[model samples]
Target: MQIYWTKINKIIEETPEVKTFLLDCPEGYTWEEGAHIHLALEGFNAGDKPNRRLIRHMSISTLPNENSIGITTRIKEQCSEFKAILRNLDVGDEMAIFKTHSNVPLKREDKNVYLLSSGVGLATFRPLVLDYFERADNVNKIHSLNVDSSKDFLFTNIFESAPDKKFASQFVDNRKDYYEEVKNLAADKDGLFYVVGSDEFLVQNIEVLLEQGIKPDQIMLDKHARQLPEFLSSDLSI
Candidate 1:
């Protein structure tokens, strides 16, 4: 993947710990929903070995509107270089951006679409929601369930305002209501289901859905990181 330099235009804290980043992509660049861009720090100072830090992948959280790409990051207590770079980034300062890629192409025309996401996983669904609302001929009804770990929920306002009845439910797992909320959504028939989240979130919810009689073929699971177990991989592939 080719990495290009992008400048951070602004950063806003959506929740206490989650922050949204607005980046100024180079002219003519565009991306689709569920696509991700890899970010890296710039300008390593003396004795600052090139921080070949793990490639941080962030979903294209918002649509490409007004020539900017939006990404949301969850701040961790360990204080990583990735977080540091994001924290210190200023307008006109450059950060690297690899072009977007995804494991599955979005099927916007699916009449009954079920979108499942947790925490930063909601980032992956942002563009999809935007696309669904933007088209004149789009006929799909979107059911989006967002799970957050109590303190780190992002963009609650956006999800709450979605016009579709199916898209309005948001889940906060701190109280254990996540499963029930997802169960209700999965009970619907003939919907194309897409799940994006941590491995545990995907696995547990997919299991719940299957237990509730959702066919395996109708569900698509995308893990945010590479820590997924083999059993889950096999299940997703089935």
Candidate 2:
């Protein structure tokens, strides 16, 4: 599918380091719960050959029924050159948006779904939480965890306001002491786990989950990395 330019409807400052862009899609593009779309600025870094056109894959955080698609991103000045472009985006600015991509499509099963995310990783797992809660049967079976610094706990209200909010857990790991709780959570062994986060974060969580007897087939992952070993790789539509 060809990439198209869409207008930016709004920019939400969730925290000092996190921003969510609400994009206007007149074509009515629809995507699955954990899907993501590529975004690029037209002619970003025009003259620089090596970095002239870099498209970033951003997860669609909003539910499919929403009027607009949204991408919540964490801004790190040292790691991204395109952040300047994103931060400067205005309400009416047009950005290049590619088609949606996802390998971990939403599926219902007898087993419960447990989602684990960290920092901006919430972008990928958020829609799943919202969609699952809409189903009366899934109300008590779904659980979630968000690990981040105390100040970086963005979008707390969204999960806290859910009908069965007790299933949602937010553990602030300011000192990296969250391992014990993480290990205990995954010991259920029968739960299906969906993980999204940085490479180190994903590795640590997956290792702990596996050590606690979770099978490889019971887990799905989307880590922020350019490449991973085939053993650790899953079908990432992005």
Candidate 3:
């Protein structure tokens, strides 16, 4: 696979535990909204096989036209080794990106789109929202629901409600309210649901959506095809 090394342009701390690393987009590197890449640390390519510990699957939080590649993530006090190393890296530090792909590209079907996420998982949908606002041709409307227990919501500037833009955004801090809103959104069975978060989060969202009559095909996830059956089997009986 072709690997492109790029330097960090800047870092924006969205919250105490969340950060957005803006990397210099390499020439000829282009991706659609909701794309993700394998971000490798400095020594990832030193050995024959890539070191799994040094590599992370991160969402490309920016669209191609935005000029910079954004990797937004949360690094709490007790995090993994990869995230700890990432948090210490300063601007101008170089990292390699490869195996870029997107499973949740914007699907404009003249239907309202709902984005449900937890904490920093909303980073995966930043580009999708931007893409819809920039060119909302096929989409009818867009609504975003994010639950961050920290209450220090990220991307508030971009997630604001815009009647003219036919977009709305809501932030909640608790799971009880978050699921209530999800159920309300799921009432619109024709709407498209895009979910991003931990496996548990995805399963919870899928279960709620399915229980509310949303079909498996109507929901979109950031997981791979091989990993989807597990999440999509929420309605199946053992």
Pick the TM-score winner.
Answer: 3
Highest lDDT: give the candidate number.
Answer: 3
Model 3, span 1-238: residue lDDT tens: 8999999999999989999999998999999899999999999879998899999999999988879999999999999999999999999999999999999999989999999999988999999999998899999999999999999999999999999999999999999999999999999989999999998898888888988999998999998889888778654422
Report the lDDT tens digits of candidate 1 across residue range 125-218. 8777767667624445777777776655666666665565445546666526777777777778677778887767767877877777787666
Backbone clashes under 3 angstroms, per model: 0, 0, 0
CA lDDT scores, all candidates in order: 0.70, 0.72, 0.93
The C-alpha local distance difference test score for the whole of candidate 3 amounts to: 0.93
Clashing pairs in 2: none
The C-alpha RMSD of each candidate to the native structure, in angstroms, is: 3.7, 4.4, 1.3
Alpha-carbon lDDT of model 2: 0.72
What is the Cα root-mean-square deviation between model 1 and the actual structure?
3.7
**Local accuracy of candidate 2 as per-residue lDDT tens digits, 1-238:** 7767889999999988889999886585778888888887867436645244467878889886887888899876665667877888899998887757775555576676777878788778778777776663533466677778745786776666443443555655552656666676787778888778876777777677777777767777763333344325432211
My TM-score estimates for the predictions, one after another, are 0.82, 0.85, 0.97
Ranking by lDDT: 3, 2, 1
Q: Which parts of model 3 are misplaced by more than 4 Å?
A: 234-238
